[model samples]
Target: MSAVIDIEELRSQFLDQEFDSQEFVLKTENILTVARASGETRAEFSDESHPDFQAPPALLCSLASGRHLPIDFPAMGGIPMDGGKAVTRHAPVRPNQTLIGKTHLHDIYDKKGRSGRMILIVARMEVYDTDDNHLATADSRMVIREKPTS
Candidate 1:
């Protein structure tokens, strides 16, 4: 597991500070393979279908990188762990379309637990199409546990 982080310190650093938004432009090719495997049929994602059949919901959910979580969290460490769930807004993605994703830190909360202190980090991500149309929005939550050390 990673060294226990000072939650207070981290909080202070982010308090009232605006996190720089990260924007990513993804091409259709970047997501097609996984989209297809996720049951997104070619007909629904073909150039011919453009502006018509929307991208499957599952495909968009699968695109998340999950890199927002801390590297040292126990569950994410060498030991097995369960990550938090992501709530997605219903939307469709189109084929041959370029999508842009914008990510920002939403909120962070601390709680007292049996192990010690636990921190919950929430991030909001929005995906848009070339025309700036909203495709989907996801609120991803990550839980990190802190254990006391002698």
Candidate 2:
């Protein structure tokens, strides 16, 4: 019996799979580096002791999983695209503090496109402090586009 496999089933294989936690200390140099690039000069982020010196929110992207998010979609003659992402900040991440992050497969859904079906994979990343306090949660969605018919 040959039956087409659904993308949800493929994703289930990785739903229980988890990645190693990544831990790193947020250095002031990095904060300033991003500040210079993002033009975020509120003194709190650039200065170490400005009474509200906190690491830039976007800096949390560095703590994201370096490896690809666990998603094994069915065969598709197409390439994956950025598709954009949505990040949510919990507690403020401070400078010079070690932060630990863990990522896992969160959700997967599909939609019909003009060319073909488009599958969207959403992976969640959670970051915490050395003390085990949750700091932030980031969910990134990537879309796999089917190759348009000639």
Candidate 3:
């Protein structure tokens, strides 16, 4: 196992600070391609020619900033792995529009698991349009655990 980690200290140092930002242009063709590859049959998601064509709900899951997590995360001395991701959409992502994704460290915590103690770090990305309209938020969870030794 790792040394004692100060969760509150890390949270205070990282949380609320913007670590990375990226801009994504939602193109019609790209949206259609992603939709089709994901086996989407909805006209609005898969058909660009549709009057109400828009990106699928899961599209934001693929949009990420340059850095997944803050580079200076506290060393928990464990094997880090991708826990999972969650996305929430507030508005339709239409084609030919630019969306800005700003990423920050949202939270940190530790819990005991079947094998040992594990630390979970949550990174949040807030998506907004040029008009400063909140469009979506994606939270990426990373798990840190010690290597199992027989």
Candidate 4:
């Protein structure tokens, strides 16, 4: 059993409020290491000396904020599960670039699942370079649902 979540209340209190922020200095060695580990075969991502050498898109996943949600999460009282993440790239991320990531509660909503009701929370993190150029946006989803009784 779980307490009912107040979607409207959560939205008003948390939406767009920054919860976590982090800074990362992209290094060629680290980027290449991640690329190779992820089995990326692209020369641009694996070869630092290549003219188009760039950080693999998957590298942004590692740059996510330390915390995904606000410290004071809503009192939904349900089993929370990771709903994965979606990343949208606006510009290429290059090595030696200093990037900042700021995360916030983007949205909260409910759905009627097969077993019961489920609440979905979305945390959006916007990434920018030292020059303030938008680089990417990562939306992490979390799902809350009631526990089944034996």
Best by lDDT: 4
- TM, every model: 0.57, 0.79, 0.86, 0.85
55-113: candidate 4 lDDT, tens digit per residue? 77677866763577788875566766887777898988888878899999888888887
lDDT per model vs. reference: 0.58, 0.72, 0.82, 0.82
As for candidate 1, its clashing pairs are 55-93, 75-81
How many collisions per candidate? 2, 0, 0, 0
Tens-digit lDDT track of model 3 for 1-150: 435677788888888799898899888888988898999998989888898898886678777524667778655666678898889989888898999999988888889878887878888899999999998898888898844444
**Candidate 2, lDDT over the whole model:** 0.72
**All candidates in order of TM-score, best leading:** 3, 4, 2, 1
Cand. 3 TM to true fold: 0.86
TM-score top scorer = 3
Report the number of backbone clashes for model 2: 0
- TM-score result, candidate 1: 0.57
User: Would you list the clashing residue pairs of candidate 3?
Assistant: none
